[model samples]
Target: MVDRLGPRYASTLGWLFATMVSMLFVYRPPLSLLMLFLWKVVGLLPRAVPPVVIARKYRDARASVLSAFNAALTLISLAGPTIIGIVASTDPALPSILRATTLLIPIVII
Candidate 1:
């Protein structure tokens, strides 16, 4: 399936998948927490796809920069849930905690 799509399509698909997984995190934290393992799977796709596409289409320096950006993004994405969990657990009001968590989503997405 991936071979048929080409690297560009594969990379775009990775972005789409990541975006969808991220949306799940925002819309339903409980469900997102339950499907956290799937996030790991989606996360791996971008790590592999972007570097391959960048190296093919651009110079080494450009590819390296893109790879670095993706790596930093992945790190931030990994940290976000843990931070949200800590906040949600520490807070007394569930709604307020959820609202706080939702606010972080846009920052992460940006």
Candidate 2:
């Protein structure tokens, strides 16, 4: 797919699909296990394409950029739950906010 469409389009579509999966999670459709399964399958590309793109684009600085990327991921993973907990405790609209944010953030980022 990347070979055919090139990395830019491929990554954009991959992320759009990911954003769709996130929306499905928010909306709670039927047969969601199927969506989840397909998401996991398709999610591989979004996880992988960036580093591979970075590797190709920044041959010399690939390690540094990838390391920084991984570090940011780690920090998000560590901080996300604590922040969620704090917000969930104080905010009555926490679920709504989570749903909106989850849906909106990826779209904006994409």
- Name the runs in model 1 displaced over 4 angstroms: 1-58, 95-110
Candidate 2 colliding pairs:
none
Mark the 10 consecutive residues where model 1 has the least summed lDDT: 29-38
Best by TM-score: 1
| Cα-based lDDT for every prediction | 0.50, 0.48
What's the lDDT of the predicted structure labeled candidate 1?
Answer: 0.50
Tens digits of per-residue lDDT for model 1, 1-110: 46898655664455445546754554443333424453444344445567767445445444455556556656556554545444433434335545455445555645
lDDT of 2 by residue, 11-109 (tens): 555544554554454344234354445444443444546786744544435445445655655554444334433333343333455445544553443
